[model samples]
Target: MAGIQDHFKRDANGNVYEVDFKYVRNHVPLNWFFEHMLDAKPKPMSGAIRYGVCPNEPACQAASVHSVKVCVKEDSWKCFSCGEHGDVVAAAAFYWRITHREAGLELMRADVDMLKHYIPPKPETAIERDDSALALVLQKVAEASPYPSKDALAYLGGRGISERVAREACERGILITIPNDAFQAKAFLTEVAGKELMERAGLWKPDKKAPACAFRPLWFRSQSHCAAEFRLMREPRDGEKKAMRYGGKSPWIWEGQTPDDYMLVEGPIDCLSAVEMGSKRTIFALPGCENWEPNWFQMMAEKNVLMALDPDKPGYAAVEKLKPVLEAFEAMVGIFNPPNRIGDLNDQLKAMRGLI
Candidate 1:
């Protein structure tokens, strides 16, 4: 039998070269071990994989009792009976009784059909951005839209943004309020950007005729006008469920110029609040807490980043995920939860102005 021992002995020392588990798993098919090493057949299932009895007959005798399912497409498996579940490297480790690292290295060196060189999957082609369309839409909104109405200004005043600042923001094309009249909003969008361009820009759903700008405050990203974010300022009507915030197709990132120092906040509103409160440091505002991009680290390399995300679970979790990436780029990262036991930067601004 071509067992594990015939191939190699276990390493007692921690001197083996580390191999990427993802790379090994990507190259090695799960069923190859069953067919080549254990000489067991895996019956094909209706999906992208096959299932058979568990191969670890000696340990649990699960093979005779339940099915061992293998998803060849994902290079993963689960033996429902024995409760054994893992990816390709985990499968190898389970069979050989070695560490996952050891199995990964072994699979890398094995003479089976596994590729000697790991070829990463080609990245999905990026769609070319229609900057002209975005610019035209923003320009039309600024020129023709009768936005930031008295009610909109009052909404900003309620949020602690001074009337003067709100007017200035609107004039600067940063603050735009859509009409509460859905028909007027849809007509304005269709006349300004056309329905086809709106759909392509992700400002309108194909199945729905209503533009995303209806009855919402649209905040254009300070850095690039390529994207706009919408937030509902009122409660949902009866039986109407709606997300609090959403955006156009493009992701938005606020650009800043303060070298080696910046503040990161969630949402353009928070960014506006911080700036309106006389925050001097450059601010990089994401569209939302969950919208942080890995590529953002490139800009923060060797920089001092102060994160003022929402003071909630998802905010802290995003900070956690971002800290390591920023640290890897040699950036000094610090955290700032909303002070006074508040929820977010905007809320803090409200508290400062005695609105909360």
Candidate 2:
């Protein structure tokens, strides 16, 4: 009885038996109880209680007639006055218009165990590991060597390549071609009339037989360690002619033990010009204006990369794309601006008389 409230009925041993209806109703608002808490009006019976017609009906009893004396110590409103009384959860369910289980769940403030069952897991990403594509491209170039000699050397000399430089290029196996047949050579000379052509004009025919040469510069980390390889294609065909794919990869840039800074030019002739001009550092040529790759930056991450491309729109575009990639690898990127209308490093060198 010590803990029992006025609304609870207790035995002499203080065991609670029932709730006091009047006290419960007093604590509940009439409108709320009418709308949510009850099933029907209650009536007094012999030793129990009976429910009257539901209040939702037009005609209903004013008070309960039940004999189950629902009373509180300080109140006298009859248990027969209201129709329902039950446990706390049941009452909450009735008031909230929800099921008993739902009411209990709602009252649980810290239950987080249900969240683990509905979340999805994440996926992994794949990366490319081999440089086979580059190797294949190099192989294609290798198969296209030994282009016509006169056209090759004339092309070199037109860019103001010196006799010593021309000889050196020849020594490096840079492909040169004189028309294999007199008629073909005569036809080529007639086609290229008025230009101070090479005595041995190298004609690069798209027909796999075109003469070509490859200069592969090797750089080693130790006497035994080959770090990188540079490939150069010499005396390429004119823009219109189909030429064999020569001048790539057999001769590639090799990173040496000593940190030798290098210049990255847009053509093999440009690299040759740099060498002729006494640039002690190695010069690597991209196949064309558009052949640069992100891997080029990765390969030269520790070296100084001077972008000596042609002074043209495509050259500028290539430089713009290459700048950020080189910087990202902590390499120094230098842009070379030529004084003349030359399109490439070799042009610039020849125009400037072999000055860097």
Candidate 3:
């Protein structure tokens, strides 16, 4: 890792003036910067410092490789490598390819909260122990009915899922139902039995209101098991009720240990397909396009990344936005366009069985 050091300057009276830099590069917006400077190409000084270079400026014949050394002193900075130097604000402006005022505005837009200013220190006697509440929640979930493995098998069969795949899902215990009317005795009985069975399987606890609806065997050791909470729909006075578009916020996936090379997909089904096909390192359905957290990508960037997004406009758009971020961190990126007829890995798996 490159080391970073804070540089500061002092005034003639010995008071600290401000941080200093050896050289300042033009400031460019992250998107534009990635497009023109970081996309697909390795810079000459990939690991070395760089400075501003105006395309319209006349070339300096005396510039040499050794001429650029990044210097940050007070508000001034210079790059010996490119013989480019300027004040701190100037450097930022050049680096971002923006004006000094723009840089200031950008800084203002950044939201940074200092916890020290508002958060009080914990009391010395404050309890510090494993969260027993989590355990109770798990117990409640476990107490819910075991996923309707048989029902899942029936549903998958109706959808043309392979018998083998259906069987695997059944054996894995991957189904649960939401109670449409909690007051109904049948619903309460089902919930009670399901919870007890799940608890016995070590899948859930009673402390949590949301029960585990899916049985993920790996979660016993890795916490990879996921559950979904559904809102039971009842017939409206005028129309039939239907389940919501997708399960509300539920933990339906688990992240395995870091992998050296991974596949990126848009849905959990694709992830399951990849896993079945022996690709262990995979990330499924990001939080959302704009919310793809940098920390998660950084973890994946440590290895080769294959973009296996759905072959659709939304998928393509996601890749377009994500490419630069991955490339900036020097990750190898490959686009995996599955067959047009097959929407994702699971579809591919089904096709292999001649179901499609």
Best by lDDT: 1
- Regions more than 4 Å wrong, model 3: 1-139, 142-148, 157-258, 287-291, 339-341
> lDDT tens digits, residues 1-356, model 3?
01111223447996544532221122222222222432212122322223333221233222332222243332344443334555544544665678665544443332224211332212123122222333443335344544433443444444345446434433343323323333442345345545555444333335644333332211110122332222222222221111211212222233435557767764434554665555556444442233355545676555688887665544677789889888877788888864454766667666765667
Cα-based lDDT for every prediction: 0.63, 0.43, 0.42
Model 2 agreement with the true structure over 1-356: per-residue lDDT tens digits: 23225445569999655555443333433322322345433333223333333322222233223222232111212222233345434445555667755544333321234222323111122122123432332232323332334544555566666666555543444433334344554444334431122112221223323222112211111111111133222432222111223222222242323464767775555666777667766666665656556766576686787777776645777788878888898888887664455656665666676533
Model 3 lDDT at residue 307 = 81
lDDT of 3 at 18: 50
lDDT tens readout by residue for model 1, 1-356 = 24422334345774444466766665576667665555555554324444554444455353222333333434667653344668877777877888888888777666643443423232223334466665666667767754576766677778987777666667667766666566877777678668877666655667775865665545453445666666656554532222323334333343345666878888777877877777666677876666666776677888898988886655777788888888998889998753465778888889899998
Clashes of 1: 0
Any runs in candidate 1 off by more than 4 Å, and if so which?
Answer: 1-135, 145-147, 171-173, 205-209, 221-224, 238-259, 337-339
User: Candidate 2: minimum summed lDDT over ten consecutive residues — where?
Assistant: 218-227
**Residue-level error in angstroms, candidate 3, position 214:** 13
TM-score, each model? Answer: 0.56, 0.39, 0.40
